[model samples]
Target: MRRIPILVTLLLVAACSQESERTYTVDELIADEALLSRTISDCRNNPGELRNTVNCHNAEAADGKLRLQNMRKALGG
Candidate 1:
């Protein structure tokens, strides 16, 4: 009986600890270039683990948007 209670408590603690972290939106990442760059670097460095994560997706989107904007500026558009 005591062992069962301890196991349940451990499971609860584990579940709380494993809660998903808040992910950044693409616009938010774009507005913060340093954060956007860091996120992209992290995702690229660990593609197997982060390729499908929300933050990675947002970071990639932000990067693409920034590149497009830069290209337009370079062409005087």
Candidate 2:
């Protein structure tokens, strides 16, 4: 009976250590895709915000764009 309690505790500990998978919906996926698409482009007209797209005039604004592209590539977008 004491051994049974130890085994149960071990099982619980193993289960708790397991990792869970994360799933995202299609809308979420598409929204992310759009954001990524925008990042790959350079907005010639606008020199202010990165706006998810690349901007030569606003190189400083490209931080999010570069980040978004890297993130999309990592996420398999």
Candidate 3:
């Protein structure tokens, strides 16, 4: 009998805790700027060699830009 109420409460809690896409604050996004710079620098440094790594770094840089853009938009900037 008690299990039924406990289960219902747990389900309700879980449902309430479910989250959509996570949003970052402007300060949090800005903190990643250095990481983005490093990713860009890594790609630029190894232009011809390690094609896979260059591609990975390029992707990271692009993602970082998008994140910053989204953060700015969220912040009404």
lDDT by candidate, in order shown: 0.93, 0.52, 0.63
Ranking by TM-score: 1, 3, 2
State how far residue 4 of model 2 sits from its true place (Å). 7.0
Between candidates 1 and 3, the one scoring higher on lDDT is 1
lDDT per residue for candidate 1 within 13-59, as digits (tens), equals: 99889668679999999999999999999999999999999999999
Q: List the residue pairs that clash in candidate 3.
A: none
TM-score of candidate 1 to 2 decimals: 0.76
Write down the worst ten-residue block by lDDT for model 1: 13-22
Tens digits of lDDT, candidate 3, 1-77? 99999999999999999595333343443566665455556656886763466344454656667777899999999
**Candidate 3: Cα lDDT at 49:** 64
Maximum-TM-score candidate: 1
Off by over 4 Å in 1: 1-19
- Tell me the RMSD of model 2 versus the true structure: 14.6
Weakest 10 consecutive residues, lDDT, candidate 3?
21-30
Query: lDDT: which is higher, 2 or 3?
Result: 3
